[model samples]
Target chain A: MAIREPIRTGGRSARVQQSIHRAVCELLATQPRESLTVPLIASHAGVTPSTIYRRWGDLPTLLADVSLERLRPDTAPADTGSLHGDLLAWAEQYVDELGSEPGRAMVRDFINSGAACQCSNLLRGQLQHITERALQRGEQAPAADLLVDQLAAPMVYRVVFSEQLPSTAQLKVWVARALAR
Target chain B: MAIREPIRTGGRSARVQQSIHRAVCELLATQPRESLTVPLIASHAGVTPSTIYRRWGDLPTLLADVSLERLRPDTAPADTGSLHGDLLAWAEQYVDELGSEPGRAMVRDFINSGAACQCSNLLRGQLQHITERALQRGEQAPAADLLVDQLAAPMVYRVVFSEQLPSTAQLKVWVARALAR
Candidate 1:
């Protein structure tokens, strides 16, 4: 089936668009994952349920989009000469941001909501790419990319699962382990 | 207020009787994370909701016990003599089991349910102990423990977040990477 994209308008769109997205997102961050319903979100957003259903078919997919939108990683590669340095800097930035209120809320939302977001899948790809680049620069032994995937992804999971901001020490440990393997 | 202890029964003083425990576990394995409610579980178990509530306080706590009861890691430390062999065995056993059908279902339940299950907190602790043991087995590097947490934990998270099971090769890659680091 051909999917028709929603049309954008300057005046009408402006009037309703920001309010709709803001309403959806605000309710998302504030409400319990289970309590999140189209009607509830609309009520919270000050719009009708039709408006919400029109934009995002169901609550799980909408929540997935919102959650994914929040964790869009900084894609620019860090070429700071040393692999360890680049990795540490990236790890620090990643951990630092994830350790915040928004990060916690996002994690909590995933924990509470039964919906599994596609963000993790996307992040896995990104993590793999970055790990490859970092390894090449470091002149480390030819480590398999899949190995990097296994070695590096779990710390982020632990942080989210435990809802604790990992210290820099954890980042160091990750780098050390990844290189060692 | 002092936490009320479970009444002694079945010769063990376990609050949740063994039959009820098995029923609750079976529900978590088969039911969708969000669909796991008192009435659903009770019906599945051929028990009344009142009985379930009397034995267990609520859905979340009941769900936690359901998942937690079976996730205890094989505490038998691998004595393969080589750190690599020991870790490989642990990763294979741990990852395979974690990615197994029943394991995935319950955890998916835990994640989707917003971790309302009281046992979610305990599950996190269990993972830590398992990881700590793996790191402690390393011959030279003392901090492989940190490495394991930092590197491999995220991939496991990725698996839980996704509905698909991770392949053994993928798991091996993750463990291999952790070993190198």
Candidate 2:
């Protein structure tokens, strides 16, 4: 008699999820987007195509899932001593991540998947964190929604619609505008 | 003898283009999005599918073209005797047009077709028209780009991502904020 891997256990499920997600990222890095398929991703991940289908439903949804994972901020917004400094630092990093070629692609995928609210929610939570930290330090900080309206909204608009990212100077101007508000 | 229609002449070509566009709008209103095809559109418009292919290249591009056509303002932004009143009226109408169900779909189609800048340029021209009218009256006006950054960006962002449109009251607040700047 052989010991069997328990079915649908957290440890095994987590590992498989990780492997699938990692396979998607690696293939996206190496392969053309148009060439990617469920079978190809499954083969790369050492799983069956049914696994991807049963879990993700389709290619766009899976791409959206992977993009959302990549977009999740790994650390808290830095405490830069003042609300202005904190907002500037956070905005710079936000642009650097979301304005890159791959980042833009992720945004498009997220939008196409019809789960754009999730992506916006991620940004909202991060901005809220920055504002709450500022309040704790006795600094006046703009509301997260206002920051989203003034700073992140414009940045995202440019990223989605324009060929160029907002310049550092432009980002600074937006930061100042939000702060002034 | 049957009169030979001028081949590829502006008059004939413009008529064909108009018919094709009209057919698309009709089909979109009545038929489900997924069921639409070039052959169907060509049949409805009484044109060959090759004509659509040769001109618009693909379905998404054709949809984007139609969406842009619909987005063009038919008249100038209303001048309400004050810049504040002008912007408020314009913003309310802007939200009403771009925040409706079909309007949101057009926005997504434009973004997906990657011709979003054309859409933005149309809006920028309208905002510039408002600002110019205000200046002609010797009233203080916010820069058009500033309005785009503060007002239009947030509106488009919400339209693209959120389930609910921004309320009329929110539009008033945004107008006040833009004018204050």
Q: Estimate TM-scores for all models.
A: 0.66, 0.88
TM-score of candidate 1 to 2 decimals: 0.66
TM-score of chain A as modeled in candidate 1: 0.62
lDDT of 2 by residue, A87-110 (tens): 788888878887776776776677
lDDT for A19 (candidate 2): 93
- Model 1 residue runs over 4 Å out of place are A1-19, A28-36, A44-60, A73-83, A108-117, A121-151, A176-181, B1-16, B26-35, B43-58, B73-83, B112-147, B150-155, B161-167, B170-181
CAPRI accuracy category, model 2: medium
Q: DockQ winner among the candidates?
A: 2
> Looking at model 2 chain B, which ten-residue stretch has the lowest summed lDDT?
B1-10
- Give, for candidate 1 chain B, the lowest lDDT window spanning 10 residues: B111-120
In candidate 2, how many Å is residue A6 off? 21
RMSD of each: 6.0, 6.4
